[model samples]
Target: MIRPRHILRVFLLTTLLTTCLTGLSACGFVGFPGVYKIDIEQGNLVTQEMIEQLQPGMSRRQVRFIMGSPLVEDTFQPDRWDYPYVIRNGPDIIREAQVRIFFEGDSLVDVTGDYLPSWANPNAEPQGSTESEETEEAKES
Candidate 1:
């Protein structure tokens, strides 16, 4: 008692349902609420701790040894180096920092951007404890 017309109707209905389901998923609606994507991190991981280690009068090799190679070193401005870091989760940026190091001749002279150097503190003594022994002995007194 199977009719050809009834079989044709069922096939058309199934095809339509399949098409609708495919469209919904293609539009990002099927698994919309609970999906997760890993955060993406790019460029140098310049940190405050690293910046604190920086000292003026340090040579280029010393800076590179401490902070790693700069992410952006301008061709025309050979003495300037830029460190940039960023983290993104999908379309949202979670964190970012930029630090610029400037050199006079071969020595690091100035640093500007996200973090401050340790020597910026008034109480902080110059690095390497280059002060005279008498000054240190006097301070102990």
Candidate 2:
């Protein structure tokens, strides 16, 4: 008893609903863009090799020749350097590296503010100490 028009209408309705459902599946979706990118591999992280190659007495020009421009240098001391790097996905990823060097006199004695942590606490000293040789030297002097 179904008419041809009624059958056509049902078929069209089902088709429209299926298409709408498929499209909506993507429209209402969120967090899916970066969902597959949750894992951040630490393998891409660079090591201190950059700084290790720099000898204590190397000049700024020599340092630059070896390590390129620094990422950061100290503001006040202008002798300590700091490098930071991070690596994300492969091609569609985030990767960066930083370098710092300090100087003494005209020669590069120490690396200072290259382009990072320029405002770090100046009073803070690195870990481990057996009383500075300066203290002993001063006492003897």
Candidate 1 weakest ten by summed lDDT: 26-35
Off by over 4 Å in 2: 1-30, 33-49, 89-100, 108-141
lDDT accuracy of residue 69 in candidate 1: 93
Residue 40 of model 1, lDDT score: 98
Report lDDT per candidate.
0.87, 0.58
lDDT of 2 by residue, 22-67 (tens): 9879765543454455435432233455445656667777776766
Report residue 11 deviation for candidate 2 (angstroms).
34
TM-score of 2: 0.36
Query: Which candidate should be chosen as best, given lDDT against the real structure?
Result: 1
RMSD of 2: 9.7
Q: Could you estimate the TM-score for every candidate?
A: 0.63, 0.36
Off by more than 4 A, model 1: 1-31, 120-141
